[model samples]
Target chain A: MPHDHDHPHSLLPPDPALRVKALETILTEKGLVDPAALDEIIDTYQNRIGPRNGARVVARMWCDPGFREEMLKDPMPRLREMGLYGRQGEHMVFVENTRDVHNVVVCTLCSCYPWPLLGIPPGWYKSDAYRARVVREPRKVLAEFGVDLPGETRVRVWDSTAEIRYLVVPQRPEGTDGMDEPDLAALVTRDSMVGTGLVPGPTP
Target chain B: MSRVHDMGGRFGDGTVAPGEDAVFAAPWHGRALALTLAAGALGHWTIDASRHARESLSPRDYARFSYYEKWLAALADMLVARGIVTEDELQAGHAAEQSSLSERALMAGSVAGVLKSGSVYDRAGPAPALVVGARVRTRRPARNTMVEGGHTRLPGYAAGATGTVVRLHGTHVFPDSNAHGLGEAPEPLYAVAFEARELWGAAAEGDEVIVDLWQSYLEPA
Candidate 1:
């Protein structure tokens, strides 16, 4: 098996952490980049924006049919209005998962994911194993992710090779009719929007 | 031609470890990502160009480097190639001289707005050639092909396969052209749906795979 990190015997820098620091130092000295800017960008993704943004969007869809229909028909404008439009998410598509269908997203060519809503993609999403195997054996891949659908449910794997980004609207769990938007959002997991994990049912 | 990054279905890739879901595995990973993005804001190269650099790595290097490592390597190469940085400066870990490009720094305050109002590739172009429900076949991969070493959005598994166009994405930037210093040359894009069997034979058990393919990659079947 190929090791994910650089080989210990390789000529490349033995310590990647130091290499990154050196790169930053040189770039900073040249005035080509600002350390403050890097921090801001990292902080934005790490703290400000994340799966919670997507969870709220998904929760709204579950509570309001009109919003869901509008979103499914034309999502970019709606997403923009909600401050969820940005880099890696300029063009968006929401693939709804229903009783008969299940949807998942992947970018085999590279790791292209929706950043504004979901933040950076998880580590596994960019793994060669997932990119290579998911397209061929999606059922098996989903099962490994602990998502097992009924045999009758059709699986649609969306390969995001172009500018279009996809988000899967997982089926709302049963017996959550009384939950409010925030409550519903709390139930939505990052994996559900990515179609790897289902939203759990309301607690007993 | 198939590249190392185009691994969609050629077996023996092993199992996916989804539990390793941290956005940044180490301190350096986040810095690598931030540095790459910050450098990218210089307008020195297009996103397609950067992607091409990453995909152009030797197979051995590509396999050994982790995801963020690839980004850093490609970013360094692009910086030197674009004359933004030099090998000496990189090696010495210091700047040799003041860069004239200082005016183009992406400031901390502007980061939010710039990221929010991202680059737009959608451009005015001719009408789409194929419509929804149109049957199409992707161009078959040849041993030596179009713009050899050029980047492509087409994955190896989908090449030469037949599928139905389920949706039209309108004309957008074609990566094949854009990645090679060619113009955007926007083309109609479509969501082509193929049964798992069509792509991987009866041994493949998935229900379907819908790929967003440019019109240039397809022809009426």
Candidate 2:
């Protein structure tokens, strides 16, 4: 191991992907990382956990008042019971949308979202546009997302700053009270859970 | 510390593209994420510290680096800074071919349990400085600048800004102090309500932004 380079100039690769590969190689070789563990982590975030999990919870809350009441009391334990508990979602706080009040979430400092419930955050949620303006112009931002509220419906933009990650429980649309859990879940969308867009209206 | 990552209140950030969201745009992004989290499991640094490193890149690098590039830089920086890995090894992209290190490595079967028992930061702490409905202001650095220079959770837009406490959240870790290897120093977190005008002047109207600020970031206004 005759590494004779005195100067510690950054030898990091210029290419982003290569740079990532390089670091992965180093960590794996150093026994600092496990490729198998990495795969499982990535697999979980990619396919298993995401907005659908949140949507399931949202639908359950809509159809089952008992569950909703318990969730409102504190969603963390309930989410854990449902097996939705995980990183970036250790603490849970649910904000409900009513005819009088609407809620949206952002992280002004950085992009922090409920990873277990919402899966990986969408790019827009992490983009500078959403983080900067949503706080100042919630109405405008929501409108951009095609979520227009009544003039009297007050909008509250939540900045996910601390340990608490917010899940916006949108109001269930009128009609169709007989829908089952699976159908209700289908109606719930990711943006709806995020407070950016509404759940799909009963198929026209 | 770089206000670079704090994009709140800036203008003309363009429109959010509409489409299905891909968890990771590239295989490397996933690798970058996995590497970060695996290192995180080792507990050498807090999540806030990793975030600060990712956000603390030089302005030019921060601006130009792609998302995962930033992650890569942060991971490398954290490793070197903490002496977990050396710059020489990182640069060489090859270790001295050692057999193995006895460090605690996350195993495949343990992913579910590790994530389910995610790192907890909400620890009991001192009583809250301000109560719900109390008017408060976010403190700023001595000299005024849009950005800060340390590991801070206080966003530039909210610094020195006035707001009202709408809800009292329980004690939670303060990210500002935690990023520098500072102790968790848990504090009461509050949901502070700021009218659009208060945060963005007349440029904003018709809505309010509620930020969760730790007790230390607030003072009676």
Top candidate on DockQ is: 2
DockQ (C-alpha based) per candidate is 0.56, 0.59
User: Which lDDT tens digits does candidate 1 get at residues A1-204?
Assistant: 222222211223547787788888888888888999999998888888889999999999999999999999989889989999899998899999999889989999899998988989999999999899888888899999888888888889999999898999989999999899999999999989988889999898
Which digits, one per residue and each the tens of the lDDT, describe model 2 over residues A1-204?
Answer: 322232121467777778777877877887877889999999988888888899899999998899999888788878888888888998888999888888898887777899988988887787777887787777788878887788878888888878789999988987768898888888898988889998766885
DockQ of 1: 0.56
TM-score of each: 0.95, 0.92
Count of backbone collisions in candidate 2:
2
Query: TM for chain B in all models?
Result: 0.95, 0.90
Winner by lDDT: 1
Cand 2, B chain, TM? 0.90
lDDT (10s digit) by residue, model 1, range B89-131:
7666778987888888889999999889977777789788898
